[model samples]
Target chain A: MQRIAVIDYGMGNLRSVSKAIECVADNAEVLVTSDAKLISTADRIVCPGQGAAADCMAALNDANLINTVQELIGTRPFLGICMGLQVLLTHSEENDGIDCMNVVPGQVKRFASPLLDTSGQRLKVPHMGWSPVAHSVAHPLWDNIADKARFYFAHSYYCAPDDQGSVVGQCEYGIEFAVAIAGQQLFACQFHPEKSAKDGLQLLRNFVAWNGKS
Target chain B: MGLAKRIIPCLDVDAGRVVKGVKFLDIRDAGDPVSVARGYNTAGADEITFLDITASSDNRDTMYHVVEQVASEVFIPLTVGGGIRAVSDVRRLLNAGADKVSINTAAVHNPELVQEASDKVGSQCIVVAIDSKCVSSPGEEPRWEIFTHGGRKPTGIDTIEWAVKMAEFGAGELLLTSMDRDGTKIGFDIGVTKAVSDAVEIPVIASGGVGELQHLVDGVNQGGADAVLAASIFHFGEYSIGEAKAFMQQQGIEVRL
Candidate 1:
C-alpha cells in the first residue's frame, strides 16, 4: 500500500485536511505526522498550512523538518495548500518580511488595493467566500474539474511567483493573483480544497491518483 | 471573479444533536449534526454555520466531536459559534476543525475579547455575532440595541455603533441577527441589517426571520448582506440549499450554484 504523509508542524487545519485526504484515499495510507523519517519514506506528501508566515516557519523549524521537507519536494509527489504555498516562496511581506523555504521563487504580498469591486462596493479584506479560479496551464489535477470553477478562499495575502511558468491558476480579488502553481513532482493551491465541495474533492482524488510525472 | 454571495445553513445543535426550535423553545430533533451538515455539503451550501445552542461545559466535548465529524466529511467552510468566551475558546474550536469561531455574549461583555482573539487567532477566524432588536418611540428615532445571553438581555450599546466598533476591533466578519424577527419567519429586518452591514467594512451575514426564498434575496439585495443565514426554512426541509442558491442566482445574486 502507498503511504501518503501530511506534514503536521503544529499549525493549519490539520484535522480537516487529513480527513479530506482520507476520504479520497483508497489504496493509500494517509498519515498526519511531523516525523521526518515517516514523511521522507512516504510515496506522496501534502504540506498543508494556515496562519502567518513567521509563525508557520517557526513551527516548521521547531519541528526540525525544514531540511526534511526541502528534500521531499523534488523527490516526492508534493502538494501545498494556502500557507503551505506561501511558505514555499522566497519571502513574504507579512511579519515584516519573513524568509520562506524558497522551494519556489516568489514573494507573498498583501492585497493592497482599495478593496473595492467595479461597482464601488467595498470588498472585504481577508477575501472570504467562494471565488472562481481560472487555470493557466493544464495538469492532471484539472482533469474533470471545469476551468474557472469556484473555490473557497479566506486569505489576505497572495503569492507572486518569479517564474510565471509555475503558475497554473489565477484568481481575481480586486487584483489577479496566482491561486495555483505546479512544478515537476509538485502541485500547490492557495484555496482550501477541503472547503471547496465537489470540485475540491475531485481535485484531491486526482492528486491521489497522479503519478507526479508532470 | 468577485467573491460569491454565500447562502449558509445554520444548525442549532443541542447536546451534540442538531435541533431547531421556535423562539429558542420547543426544540425538535432534526438529525445528527454531522449528518445534517453532510447533507448541506452535498446539496451545495456555500458554507455551514453550527451554533451550539446548549453551550454548557459538559457538552463542550460533544460539540467538538460534532465539529470534527462534520469537518471531516462535509468538505466545506464551517463556522462554529456559541459559548465562545475568550481567545482560548476560539483556538480550541479552530483546532477542532472550525474555520471560524463566532463569539456573542462574551464579545459584548469584554469587547476587547474580539480584538484579542482577532490578534491571536488571526481576524479571519474570529467572527463577532450580534443579536439586536429595534427600539422605537412615539417621537424619537428608532434604533437597534445589542442583546446578549441569547437575545434575552439587552445591552445599551447601539447596534450600528457596536458593529462599527467590532469591525474596527479586527473582526473579519459579522453575523447579525435581529432578535424581534428571529424565529418569526416573516423576513429579515432590512433596516437593522442594512444599518449594521453598511456600518461595517467586513462581510455581514444577515440572519434571522427567513420565511421563504424571497426573504433571502431581500436580505442580500435590500439588506446588502454579504451572506444570508436561515435555520427552520432549511432545517425543516421547506427549502433546500440548492433551491435557495437557485433563487438567489435567478435574482441576479452571485451564488455558487
Candidate 2:
C-alpha cells in the first residue's frame, strides 16, 4: 500500500489525525508533512482544517504549497475536510469577496435561519456539537460509516456546492447542507473524522482502503 | 441563524493532568487531559474547554507544560481558562497553542481587561467565561448573578447585562457556566443559558449540569446554546466518544461523521 500524506499546513489537527490514521490503517503508512516533495509522491492526500476557512486558506497561501496541492489532486486520490473543502469552493461568505482555491464549484455560507427554543426565543451562532446526519448518497467514504453516524462539528459556515452531483452526504440543521462532497477521486467532509468515534474511524479506514486499491 | 447549541468537554487539568470532580470541590481520580481529549474527539465533542483549576494557586509550576501537551495532541478547537488573569497569561496560553483563552474573575474586576486582551490577542481568542445562578422569583424578572473565584465569591453582576457589555468590548465568545449545576449533572440552567446565549451575539458555550446525552441535545435544541460543555460523563467513563456521537446523530443534528 502506498503511504497516505496528511498535509500539515499548521491549520488542521495533525497529531490526533495522525494517531487515528495509524489506528485504522494497518498496512498503509500515514505521514504528516507540509513538504511538497514528499506529498507529490504520495498515493493519497488528505487535507483537514479546523479554524476559520479564511485563516486556513491564509495558512495554505503562506505555506506556498497550493499549486503543488492543485496538481497532485488532479492525478492522485485527494480528500479535503471542513475548510479544506470550502477553499475548493468558488468563495466564502466568511471573508466576503475573497477568491478561494476553486477546486470545486461552490460557495461556503453561514446558517441563516433563526431556530429559537430559548426562554426568550433566540438561538446562538457557531453551532457546535454532535448531531444526527443523514447520508445523501452512497460514496466510498460511507463504506463502513452508517447513516446518522455522529461526527464532531464546530463551524457556522458550510459548503453549498454549485454542482449538486458532487455532494455525497447531507446534514440538516435549520436546513440541509452538503456534509460530504466528491469530484471523481476527490472527496471531503466538513466534520472532523479524527474526533468522531467508530464511524469516523471507519470513514478514515474507507479512504485508506480506497487509496490502496486505486 | 439563531444562537447555536455547542457540545463541549470541560477538562479539569489538575497538576498537568485532567481530573474529574465530584461536586466542584472534590477532585480525586481522573485521567490525563491528552487522553481525555483524544477520547472526546473520537466521541464527537463539539469543542473542548480545559479549566486549569489549580493554575491560580502556588502549585502553578506546569502552566505551559499542560496546555501545550494537550493542545499539541488534539486537532479540535480548545478554550483554556480557570486561572488566566493577566495579558501575558493570555498570550502565554495562546502561544502554547490554545485556540481561546477564557477569563473569569479578571474580566469582572478589570472590565477593560477584555478590551486589552482582545486588542493584543484578537477578540476571537478572548472568551469571557461567566458563571451565574438564577435568582428569579416567579413574578419578578429573572436575575442572573455572576459567580467568580470558582463560585466562592459573588460578583453582584447581572450575567445578561455583563454579556452584552463584554460583547460590545470585543469578546468573541461567551463561556457561560451554571454554578448551581457545576457537578450536579442534572442538565444545564436553561433559563440562564437562554438569557446569556440570547443576549450575546457571539457564540455562547452552555456548560454545567450535563448528566446524559439528552442534556447535550437540550443544551442546543432547547437552551439555544451554540455549544454544550460537559466533563463527568466523558471523564468517569460513563460514556464513550462514539456513543455520544451516535446519540447525537440519532437526534437529527448535523455532526461530523
Candidate with maximal DockQ: 1
Tens digits of lDDT, candidate 1, B121-206? 66778889999988876467779899888788978899999999998898999999999999899999999998887776688999
Supply the global lDDT for candidate 1: 0.87
Docking class of 2: incorrect
- Cα lDDT of model 2 by residue, B90-118, tens digit: 76776565767899889998989888887
User: Per-prediction TM-score, please?
Assistant: 0.94, 0.75
Per-residue lDDT over A1-214 for candidate 1, one digit per residue giving the tens place of the 0 to 100 score? 9999999997878888888988888788999999999999999999988777888899999999889988788787899999889999999998789999999998999886557766776777778899999989888999899999999988888999999999999998877889999988999999999889889989999999998966
In order, what are the TM-scores of chain A for the candidates? 0.97, 0.91
Model 1 chain A: worst 10 consecutive residues (lDDT sum)? A112-121
Chain B TM per candidate, please? 0.94, 0.88
Question: In angstroms, how far off is A172's CA in candidate 2?
Answer: 0.8
What's the TM-score, to 2 decimals, of chain B in model 2?
0.88
